[model samples]
Target: MARHAGLQGAGRQRHGYFEHWRRKDAGKPSKLGANKRISDEALLVHIKAIHAEVRQEYGWPKMWKELLARGIRVGKERVRKLMQRHGIKARGKRKFVVTTDGKHDLPIAPNLLARNFSPAAPNQTWSSDITYIATDEGILHLTAINDLFTARWWAGCPTGPPDQESCSQASRSFRYRSANGRPLADNRWR
Candidate 1:
């Protein structure tokens, strides 16, 4: 082929014509955008749009699926690489800690309601409980107060630490709503 192009002959030594191919820098990294078949800008635009649409919750695999769903033809590894290069990461799962502390000095209230979750009238029984949820931010302690009859949230206070203060705040919402100012059933929280 070289001979037909009049560049090299079998008897002649190799010259500058092939220097670009046989250079010592062959294994070195190429400049950015050296490969032009795939435009990084376009792919990045799509990735950014997908990230925004999904609220940055999708990791590489799910992000790749979302991109494919959006009609973008690209490999999963390519999307992974792009996200890594751009420092795009998903919200990680937070470590959860049980907030319930049974070893407390507060006196326990008697279970007057006693397994009777069903209340006959509103405000007759306001049940309260504390629940913990794991979020990317951190552990959140949610104290909820609800009417047993209607099963509606009378009040809810989401706070950190799940301490007695939060429980008091949640109960206050029910207390503030009591129209007759009557004490709660079972004569608690007076």
Candidate 2:
């Protein structure tokens, strides 16, 4: 038993595992070599340059990958720690905007339909709505109208600015269909 204990102690000492329990210098900064400190600063400069070149969007994971591609030997966590320490962070997603404004003193339209979607016949009840769509170019506003009974789409217009006049004009000009095999309403564009 004594021999076994002695052997275990010897193995621990050999592997320098005792250092794990030893106290470190808490007050003073680490005594890194001059060359190491200089290299660390140089790495930080390179990181900042890359961040700016990428429009400051790349986070630590991507930055770590970039560093790896540039032949910089660094860990991902180390890069994260460095970024956090230097106050570097990635941009967040944009917030959605509410396009509707209800604060105006204009006369509010009464809900004639009253959520009664079942219409007696085609064109008996029409529904209109507008929504905004995000795209690569920019936000697109789509205004559309449909018949509640026939489920037929009456009119639709996609505009950039989404003004009220254009939407009303577009819907008003939309005639149902005529022959030449269009729809059913006589659509004559004047």
Candidate 3:
């Protein structure tokens, strides 16, 4: 039988070689049983239903797990292929937001430092800035005050965007007498 099928003696001895050729010649399904398998259209229906239930928040991994959890037995790679073919995707979380209004008619702060980052002494020139940090809970607004010469810095995590009050609070916390007694650099320009 192996010689007729063009399989050598060693190849015939390999597991499932004869069975595979036998099934192929007979036009029968393999041992894995194709009878229980549903059509791609049917599977896609289930996938779309689950996607809507979760508000399209689950990718292939989560979607496959959800299918298994719901008593629908399917392969993970199959789920991924179907989702990719059908243009199904998870809605990603927004990581960045434009907080600044550049078109507004707001008064800009003057550049007092004149690009001199290296100060002669500590407290001679203090700078402050505001930034954001992403956390599991939400985004945190960080207001930081820095002494250019000494490189000493203080930071405060405010609830919302760093406003005048938040920046003032951060500057107040870092109590150091400035050499020229100038206020902390305004962060509104940032």
Best by lDDT, which number?
Answer: 3
- Tens-digit lDDT track for model 3 on 1-190? 5354654544544447667668878998776464487789999999999999999999999999999898778899999999999999999996667887789687777778888888776777777778888888877888777778878766654657667777767666665433354555763434
TM-score of candidate 3 on Cα atoms, chains taken together: 0.53
| Consecutive 10-residue window with the lowest summed lDDT within model 1 | 181-190
**Candidates' lDDT values, in order?**
0.69, 0.66, 0.76
Q: Cα deviation of 148 in candidate 3 (Å)?
A: 0.6
Two-way lDDT contest, 1 vs 3, winner: 3
Poorest 10 consecutive residues by lDDT, candidate 2: 178-187
lDDT of 1 at 160: 87
**What would the TM-scores of all predictions be?**
0.54, 0.50, 0.53
Off by over 4 Å in 2: 1-76, 81-89, 176-190
RMSD to true structure for each model, in Å: 11.1, 10.6, 8.4
Clashing pairs in 2: 177-185
- Cα deviation in Å at residue 131, candidate 3? 1.3
Candidate 1, residues 1-190, lDDT tens digits: the string is 5433654544543454355444536863243323444577899888888888878898999988887788666888898999999998887875665545688798876666768777667777776666777799977877777777777875478898766666777776668877633323332331
Better of 1 and 3 by TM-score: 1
lDDT of 2: 0.66
Work out candidate 1's RMSD over C-alphas. Answer: 11.1
TM-score of 2: 0.50
Off-target runs (Cα >4 Å) in candidate 3 are 1-58, 61-77, 81-95, 176-181, 187-190
